[model samples]
Target: MDHIRPLPAYLVQRYHGWRATSFAENRSWYRRLADEGQRPRAMVISCCDSRVHVTSIFGAEQGEFFIHRNIANLVPPYEPDGDHHGTSAAVEFAVTSLKVAHLIVLGHSRCGGVQGCYHMCSGHAPELDEKTSFVGRWMDILRPGFARLPEGDDATRQQALEFEAVKVSLENLMTFPFIAERVESGDLSLHGLWNDIAEGGLMALDPRDGSFHPV
Candidate 1:
């Protein structure tokens, strides 16, 4: 793959810095992890947004959290079609093999993916309506969330859909038999979180009222 370039100089420098300090300090821990394997207690599904740092937000140590990031941090309904379902595969592995104690779906404000979904569903993004558009097809998962949002201005509707996306993911996670079983048996728990990137604020979904509160 001649097209594939080497790591950028800045990233290389950052890696070296981390290797010299954090990796150096945790050398033994790293080795131990390699030998024994990772046993992360939680599986975090979050957006692929660079600004949203899941581990840093939770102050999680290496091997402490299993993270899977996607365009909108979505979990599709359980479909054993035997196709290439990346997100579903990750969820299955986390629940069945990793046996994670918790599964968290994290959403954020000003998400481009969510905005795209809003536009597509609201008839504002005609290009995404094409059958060949991967993003459009994938964003179908959020359409139900978009439908749940009340009529409002573009900004308000976008924010509402963002919250609904997390709720949608949580509901989809339950569609997985293993996940639902674990939840019923008290072996696993599910959580939804929304992050405000600009304000550096986090709100957690309350199961009682189905509302988000500051965390």
Candidate 2:
């Protein structure tokens, strides 16, 4: 066995204690939820980053929000193939089946998938050929946005390009028929967000200013 750390064990025991108390006091709350059905208010589209957990960030309980995570948190244009479409399938289930009122695209700083896209577009990445990683295929969806970036190799340009990827995903979200219909009917709202892990702050896209604003 690996080294036994006290921190994780301590956290687990304390967390279970809290959970037990909560469950005891609100046992009917869970039973009532089973009797009824899930009626979450929002759906979150996020990255498959270990550092960014939706339930932890939103302080959500068990059945509060519908969450879907994928490489780079991309929302591809609806195109059905025989292949398994995990992200798109989750979105369809959340929007069509659950009928969530809000769809939040949560982007964060220092995303490895986004960084891989940068390296691939910059021609710095080696040819993987038949050994392509999942990030390669996932970042392929953002190729258009990457190609649209101005020629540069500065840190500022790289950061800007990363944000551009998120903007691209926001636009791609509109490609879904159900999402578009809901937006048109004012039944659903789509929001894009950028979380600064270092600063512990959030920036929301402001159409008026054409920039991200503090949230």
Candidate 3:
């Protein structure tokens, strides 16, 4: 621990404040959650964007939802190769181990990751086109989604691609055999959600029409 630096004064002060307020108010609940283990009914795969507040939108308490955050909230296709796959690993644990009834992919408007993919694919971002860029490689998963987007102006295209990203993640989630099995047996349900960050509006993908409707 000698190499570790001390926490910043502001963050330390904020942590102590939370520990005294929220933690104190929910002391018994927190202790019960720790003792019983988390049995979250839903597993939410969301973007790492600070503006996308999944817990606040759903009013989810601690231990109520298992959240996995990453760039653009994407779920790549299932690949069984012996390699490190963080997203797939999380999905396996959520489905097989946790037995979460609902798996939600939450995408938000103006996502940097999605925009990066958009620019990269459109030959607008040369930096991201480099093979050495980890973000570029990761955003490649969204290439197919971008290709499917209808032609439009920059703003319209960006919004369409955002929606496509959610659809793509939903499709990829089904590529996992375990997930597919549970979904087929009606034990698991998949959902796609897009949040309008500035407007605080949410859109839910309708399974029947394959369209997103404001919710």
Total clashing pairs for each candidate: 0, 0, 0
Q: Model 1: per-residue lDDT, tens digit, 115-160?
A: 9999999898999999999999999999999878988798998999
- Collision pairs in model 3: none
Cα deviation at 75, candidate 2, in Å, is 1.1
Candidate 2 all-Cα RMSD = 4.0
**1-215, model 3: which lDDT tens digit per residue?**
78999989999999999999999999999999989999999999999999998999999899989899999999999999999999999999989999999999999999999999999999999899899999999999999999898877999998899998899999999999999999999999999999999999999999897789998
TM-score on alpha carbons, each prediction: 0.97, 0.84, 0.97
Q: How much is the lDDT of residue 105 in candidate 1?
A: 96
lDDT (C-alpha, whole model) for all candidates? 0.94, 0.81, 0.94
Worst 10 residues of 2 by lDDT: 126-135
lDDT, candidate 2, 58-98, per-residue tens:
78997899988888778887887778888888888998999
Better of 1 and 2 by TM-score: 1
